[model samples]
Target: MKIARIEVDGARRVGVVDGDRVQPLAAHVTVEEVLAATPAERTALVDRAADGAPRPLSDMRLLAPVAPPTLRDHITFEEHLEGSLKLLGRTAPPPEWYEQPVFYFSNTNAVIGPDEPVAVPPGCERLDFELELAAVIGRPGRDLTPEQAGDHIAGYTLFNDWSARDLMAPVIPVGLGPVKGKDFANTLGPWIVTADELAPFRRDDRLALEMHAEVNGVPLPGGGDTSASMAWSFEEIVAYASRGAELRTGDVLASGTCGTGCLLEYWAQAGDAAPPPLRPGDVVTLVVEGIGSVSNRVVAGAEPVPVPKARVGHARRPRPWTST
Candidate 1:
C-alpha cells in the first residue's frame, strides 16, 4: 500500500493512495504508529481503517509520508560517484571510498514534505538538487547479514537532498561529514510505498526505474535516465551500516545522488559559473517510478539589512591587545 500523512481542515490524518485518490486511514494511527505496533495489531488496524468512512484525497494536503525519521544514511552509487569524481579531476573513488559502503547523517529537523518551500541560506551562491530513492526501515536489528537486511526494509519514497555546493566545498577537504552545507533542507514524499510493491524493482547492479528532476519547467542536466545506472544495492548499504551497530524502525536510508542526479554532474568544475542558484519562485520536481514525484518551491530567505556604525570621537581609542 502507498501510505501518506495528510492535513485536512487543520487536522492531520493517515491515508493510503488508491490511484489518484486517497482513502483516509485513521487520524491517530500514523505510519510510525503502525510500524511500532505488532504485526497482528497492524493488520487489524489496516482492516478497520479500510472499513471505516474515509475522507477524499482532494480535500487534503499531503504531508511527509513518514513521521520524523530517527536517523538517515546517504548511500553512494557508482554512476554518481564516477560522475562526481570525474568532475573533480579523478577517474574514480579512492580504494577506501568503495571498499565498504560509506554514508553521512542528515539533519532530522530539516526534512520537509512535497510542495513545501525550501529556504535558500545566506551566502549560498550555488544551490543544487539531488534526485534519489529513500529506503525506510521496518524492523530493528543489529549486526545484520546481507540476507537479514532485506527483511528489515518497510518501504520506499522519492528524496531530494537539496545542496549548497559553495558551502560544501570548504568542509569536504577536512574529511568530515557534510554539516551546514547539507543540513538546510531534505525533501521526501508523495508517499511511502510498501516493500512488497517495489521488491521487483530492486536489483543487483541497481534498481531499474526512471528518475528525473526539473528546475521551474525546464529539465536540468542529467535529468533523464533509469536508476539502473547504480553500481551498488540498497541491501548492501543496509547490511554494512548495521555491522556492529543497530538499525531501528523509522530509520531512513537514502540512495545518495544518482548519476546525473544533480547539477554537480556537469557543472562542479565551473566554479562560479554554475547555473543560477535556486531562487524564489523556482519549482523543483523529482520523479521516481513506482513511488511518486516530490515537487517543492524555492523561496529566498529574508535578506538581513546592514546596520551603519556610529563614529566615535578621537580621544578614546587607546586600548592595547593582551595575549591569553
Candidate 2:
C-alpha cells in the first residue's frame, strides 16, 4: 500500500493511495500511528477507510509522509563516495569507510514536504540536491541484529538532502559535520510505499530500483544509478544505528547520495563542462522506481544576521592535585 499525508485546509490527514484516488483515514489518524500498527490492524484500518468515498489524489495537496523524530543519513554508495572524494583530490574513500557504514544526524526542524520551496541560503552560490532513499522505522528496537532490524522498517520514501556547497567548503577543514551547508532544507515525500509493496524490487537485501534526477526538465548527470549499487545494505545500516540507541517509529534512515546524484560529483568529474549552480526559480526533482518523486522549487532566502568574528582568549593555568 502507498500511504500519503495530505493537507486539508490547515490540518494534515493520512490516507492510502489507490491508483488516482486516495482512501482517507480518520482525521485523528496520523502517518506515525498507522506505521506503528500491526499488519492485521493496518489491513482493518484500510478496509474501514475504503468504505468512505475516495478523493482524487491530484486534488489534494501532499505533505511529507511523516515528520520524523530523528533523521540520520548514511553514505553507503561506494561510487558516490569515490566520486565525492575527487573534490578533495583523493581518488578513493578512507579505509575506515569500507569497514563500516558511516552516517550523521540532520536537523529535523529543517524537514519539508513535496512541492515546497527550498531557499538558497544567504551567500550560497552552489546549491545542490542529493538523490536518496529513506526508510522509516516502524518498531522500536535497540541493539538489534541485521535480521531483527529488517523487521523494524515500515516503508521507504524518496529523500532529497539539499546542500549549500559553497558554505560547506570551509567547514570541511574544521573536522565537524555539515552545519549551515546542510540543515537548511531536507525533502522526504511524495509518499511512502510499504516494504511489502516493494518486495519484488529487492535483490537479496539491496533494492534494484532505478534512481534518477532532473533540473528544470533537463536530466542531470548520474542518471542511471540504482539502489543496488549500495555497498552497505539498509539492514546493516539499521542494525549499526541501533547499536546504542533506540529506533523509534517515524525515525528516518536515509541512504546517502546515489553515485553522481549531485552536482558536486558532476563538478568534480566534469571540470569545464559542468552546469552552473542552482538559482532562484530552478526546480529539482528526484525519482526512485517503486517509490514516488519529490520535487521542489528554489527561492530566495532571507538576509542573514551578522555576528562578531571569533577571537583568541587567554589560556588558563593548569591545576595540579598531585605532581611527581
Candidate 3:
C-alpha cells in the first residue's frame, strides 16, 4: 500500500493511497501512529476494513512519509563517492568505504515534503539536490544480521539530501563534517510505498528502481540504476546500523546520492567549467521508478543566517595559553 500523511483542517492524518485517492488508515492522525502498527497490521492497510472516506490525492498535501526519529544518510554508491573524491583529486574508492557502509546523522526536523519551497540556506551560493532511496524501519532491532534486516523495513520513499557545496568544501578532508551544509533542509515524501506493494520491483533483496531528475523543466540525465550501482545493499546498511544501537520505528535510512545525482559529482566530471549551482527560483523534481516524484521550488537567496565561527575556547583571555 502507498501510505501517506495528509493535512486536513491543518492537522495531519495517515492515509493509504489507492491510485489518485487516499483512504484514511483507520483512525490514525499521524504517520508516527501508523508506524506503531505491527508489520502484519501495516500490510493490512490495503484491506477494506482500513480504508476511510476517500479523498482525492491531488487535494492532499504530502509530508515526509515517516515522522522524525533518527535520520541516517548512508553512502553506498562507489560511483558517487569516487566522483566526489575525484573533484578533491582522488583516483579510486577509499579503502575504509569497502570496510563498512558509512553514514552521517542529519536533522530530521528540518525536512520538507513534496511541492514545498526550499528557502536557500543563508550564505550558501552552491545549493544542490541529491536523489536517493529511503528505507523506513518497521521493527525495533539490534545486532540484526544482514539476512534479518529486510523484515525490519516498513517501506521506501524518495529522498533528496539537499547540500550546500560551498559550506561542505572547506571541511571535506577533516572527516568531521559536511554538517552545517547538510543540516538545513532535506526533502522526502510523495508518500511511502510499503515494501509489499513494491514486490514487482524487487530483485533478490534490491529494488530495481531507476532514479530520474529534472531541473527547471530540463532533464538532468545520468542518474545511476539503483540496484546495479549500489556497492552495499540496504540490508547490509541496516545490519551495520543496528550493530551499536537499536533500529527503531520511523527511522529513515537513506541510500546516499546516486551517481550524477548532484552537482558535486557533475563538477568532478565537467571540472572548473561545470555549470553554476542551483539558483533561487529553480525547480528541481526527483523521481524514483515505481514510486512517485517530489518537486521543490528554490526561494530567492537572502543573506543566509550566518553560522557562528568555530571556536574551541569558551572563555575570553588575550592569548590564554601560558606555556603550561
Candidate 4:
C-alpha cells in the first residue's frame, strides 16, 4: 500500500493512495504514526478508507512521508566508494570502509518534500545531488540480526542528499565528515510504498528496480537498476545501524548513493566538465522503481556563511571547517 501526507488548503493530512486518488483518513495520522502501527493497525487504516472518500491526488501538495525523528545515511556501494574517493583526490577507498558499512547522521530539520525548493547557501559555488533509496523503520528493535532486519522496515522512499560539494571537498581528507556538505537539505517522498508492496520486485538480495537521476530533465551520469548494484543489503545496513542502540519507529536510513548516484562519482567518471555545479532554478530528481520519485528545485537563499580559506604555512595544515 502507498501512503502519503498531503496538504489541502494549507491543512496537512495523511491518506491512503489508491490509484490516482488519495483516501483521506478520518483522523489525521502523521506518516510516523503509520509506521509505528502494527500490521493489524495498518490494515485498520485501509479499512477506514470507507469512512471518507479519496480526493484526486492532483489536488494536494505532497510532503515528506514522515517528520523524521532522526536521519542516517550509509555508504554501501563500491562504485560510489571508488568514485567518491577519486573526487576527493584519494587513490583508493579507506581500508576501514571495506571492513564495515559506514554512515553519517544528517540534519533532519533541513528536509524538503517533493516539488519543494532547496535553498542554495551563499559562498557555495558547487551544489550537487545524491540519488538514494531511504528505508523508514516500522518498529523498535536493538541488536537485530540481518534476517530480522527486513521485518523492521515500514516502507521505502526516494532520497536526495542535497550537497555542497565545494564545501565538502576540503573537509573529507581530514577523515571526518560529509557534514556541512550534506546539511543543507534532504529531499524525501512523493509517497511511501510499504515494504510488502515491493516484495514482488525482490531478487536474490537487492530489489530489481531501476534507479535514476536527472537534472532539469536531462539524465545525469551513471545510474542503473538496483539488482546488479547495491553491494550491502538493506538488512545488513539496518542490523549494523541498530547495533548497541534501538532502531526507533520513524527513523530513516538511506542507501548512500547507488553507482554514480552523485556528482562526486560522476566527476570521477567525466571529470570537471561532466555537469556544471547546480545553480539557482536548477531542478534535480531521484527515481526508484516501484517506489516513487522526489524532485527539488534549487533556489538561492542567504549567501552561505563564508569559510576562511585554508593556507598551509610552516609545516602546519589549518582546516577551515574544523581545527584539528
TM-score per model over all chains: 0.86, 0.95, 0.90, 0.90
- lDDT at 59 for candidate 1? 72
Question: Candidate 1's residue-wise lDDT over 73-97, tens digit each?
Answer: 5657777777677756798778887
Which one is best on TM-score? 2
Which one is best on lDDT? 2
State the lDDT at 233 in candidate 2: 84
- Residue 160 of model 4: what lDDT? 89
The C-alpha lDDT values of all candidates are 0.76, 0.87, 0.81, 0.82
Is candidate 2 or 3 superior in TM-score?
2
lDDT of 4 by residue, 1-324 (tens): 888888866778887888889877655566677887777789886676433667899887898878788899998878777887776677888788887778999999988789999988666888888888988999888999999998899988888888898878777778678657878899889888888889998888766678888889887754454734777788888999999989998899998888867776766777774678888999888878897677889998786565698676657566798656
Model 1 off-target regions past 4 Å?
36-43, 50-52, 204-206, 221-223, 269-274, 303-324
Residue pairs with backbone atoms closer than 3 Å in model 1 (clashes): none
Q: Which ten residues in a row have the lowest lDDT in candidate 3?
A: 43-52
Pairwise lDDT winner, candidates 2 and 3: 2
Position 230, candidate 2: lDDT: 87
For model 1, give the RMSD to the true fold.
Answer: 5.7
**True-structure lDDT of candidate 4:** 0.82
- Once model 1 is optimally superposed onto the true structure by TM-score, how far is the C-alpha of residue 4 displaced, in angstroms? 0.6
lDDT of 2 by residue, 154-190 (tens): 8999999999988888988887888899979999999
* RMSD to the hidden true structure, all candidates: 5.7, 2.0, 3.0, 4.9
